[model samples]
Target chain A: MKNNIRVERAIHGISQQQLADSVGVSRQTINAIEKGRFVPSTVLAMKIARYFNKNVEMVFALEEGD
Target chain B: MKTSFLLPNKCKKLGKAIFVISAILGFYILFIEESYADGFLIFDSWQAVKNNIAIIGSLLGLALVAFSKERVEDELVMWLRADAMIKALWLSCVLVFLCALFLYGGIYFYYLSVAQYIVLLLYIFIFRYNMYKHIKNNEE
Candidate 1:
């Protein structure tokens, strides 16, 4: 899975901590998502996307191998 | 993430204190007291009581530490915990299998005794390491 969470955060001018707090998760989780080290569950993905006022497809996308 | 069957985050500190205190007590009772004794298997009534206390305390402490919730029991932490548990069980099983194959006599029995607690210890170690890496990777 690939995510443009970093880009989204930059565009929104929010730190990882802010996003994590808004999504009811830890900052490390936001970092992991941005780094593609961890994939969020459906609910979490939806929450993150909703936090950014975007759709899930806008923040996350399927990579060729994923 | 609706974490179930996990102790509250505060339990971690209490569990850690219990583990450390009991571990030190166990070490003192096992090694220091044994050194003054002539042979093995020499347990008086008080010694037996103290030994049992140490064993039970350690077990309870490890259980608390192993099952306590993280500060934020989010999905990622839960996933890391589950992953660590699976890895810990597999590794402990392998350790026991190797010990069975290569060890015998009293030493084998010693390791077998240790096998009871190794799973939880390994779980704690691996989970904490993963958490450390997770946090470190995010450091600015």
Candidate 2:
């Protein structure tokens, strides 16, 4: 799965730490998600999307191999 | 279950301290006596004690290190911990199965008592150490 977390963070002019705090996770989790090293659980995906005020699909998407 | 699953990251310092103490005691037991004239069986008493010390200390240290929270207890960090544990246990089971042929015979458990504990510690160390290295190296 691919995620637009980094791009979204940039768009919001927020640091990774800020986003992490907003979603109640650590910055490393966000970084891992952005790099595709960790896939968020459904609750976490919704939380992130909710933070960004975007649909879950807008924040996360399927890659060809995923 | 999750609430009691791990100690906070601040406890890693305690883990490190215990590891150092264990290492020191292990070495002390190993080298405190040497009977060149007695050959391998020279200090059998000390050797047994050393092995026991090694087993307990290593297990304690490995458990603390493996279960303690990371500096950042994010989903990925939790995942990594779980990943290391699963991988370690899988490899350990395979090794123990293979070694059990010799490690556990009838009832002569003490013959190679240290083998199982050492293998467990090695598995935990190898998996977690490499996983942590990967995480730190990939930090962007």
Candidate 3:
């Protein structure tokens, strides 16, 4: 899956650590997600989307390869 | 995001400390105890020391669990736990097979002992590294 999480976070001027804390995850998880090294579970993805006040589809999308 | 699943920094710090203490005790037992053997025997001085270490380690581990702040759901915790168990199972099976081959080839007892220790160390290293990576990667 590909996501615009980094861009969204940057636009909101929110650090990854802050976002991670808000969502109850470690900063490393946010880093991994931004780096495309990990895929969050459904619940986590939803939580991220909720934190951004965006729909899940807007934040995360399945790539053609996926 | 939920904060419930993540271990607090204090808990992580305690866990690391416990692991280091346990490792040190293990090394002491392995190197300083002359009567230590692969098989179990009646209680002795070495066994007494080992028992004390085991009890202390278990207490530390339990304390960590008791003091944890974040209450992650069991299901989510199971994901990482299952991964670790799978890794351990695979590694242990391979080590056992290799040990069998060595035995069949008439390797010395010392060689077998060293091999077992190396395998045990490797297993611990791999498990700890994987767990750390998993936790680090998943931090919010």
Candidate 4:
């Protein structure tokens, strides 16, 4: 899955650590998501979307051929 | 979507406590035992002390893990842990093979024993350090 988490976080000036703590996960997880090295679980994706007050579809989407 | 459960802090706490107690008991067994030589191989007083501590600690840890609430694990954290475990296993296996080769080449038994302990220590330290780094980096 491709996500706009990094861009969203940057717009809000929220660090990865801040987001991770809010979601009860390690910062490494956020970093991996931003780097496209990992895909977040549905729960985590929803948490991130909630934090940003955006729909999950707005933040995450399937890439072409994914 | 909110899950029906939260993080299992109790389990994590118990695991940490068990790890600390095990480390302290290990130190005593390694350095403070009277008749350390016998303690290493026989069921002597010091050996008994170590065994009891280990058994109790492990049981408690297992219980905590089994009974605790389920918590979500991030994919990245899981991957890092798996990677660290694989690396540690590989390193330990290589050390064991090297030790066997040395023994086959007629290295003295006493030196081989010391070497084996050193290798075990090194493996543990490396595994722990790598895991810590991974966790820290992710958190930063």
Cα-based TM-score, every candidate: 0.87, 0.70, 0.60, 0.53
Top candidate by DockQ: 1
Once fitted onto the true fold, the runs of candidate 2 whose alpha carbons sit more than 4 angstroms away are: A64-66, B1-3, B30-58, B97-113, B130-134
Error of 3 at B22 (Å): 7.2
Instruction: State the lDDT of candidate 4 residue by residue for A1-66, as single tens digits.
Output: 899998999999998889989988767778878878778778789999999999999999999988
Which parts of model 3 are misplaced by more than 4 Å? B1-84, B104-123, B131-140
Q: Number of clashes in every candidate structure? A: 0, 0, 12, 2
Please name the candidate that would achieve the greatest TM-score relative to the true structure. 1
Of the pair 1 and 3, which is ahead by TM-score? 1
lDDT of each: 0.85, 0.69, 0.64, 0.64
**Model 4 CA deviation exceeding 4 Å by range:** A63-66, B1-75, B104-127, B131-140
Best by lDDT: 1
Model 4 clashing residue pairs (backbone): A27-B138, A28-B138
Question: Distance from true position, residue B124, model 3, in Å?
Answer: 3.9
Residue range with the least summed lDDT across 10 consecutive positions in model 1 chain B = B35-44
- TM, chain A, every candidate: 0.95, 0.93, 0.95, 0.94
Q: List, residue by residue over B25-136, the lDDT tens digit for candidate 3.
A: 6556655654454434435466766745643664564345333443332223445444655776687778777767766543555445345344334434554576577666
CAPRI grade, predicted model 2: acceptable
Write the number of the candidate with greater TM-score, choosing between 1 and 4: 1
Model 1 pairs in collision: none
**lDDT of model number 2:** 0.69
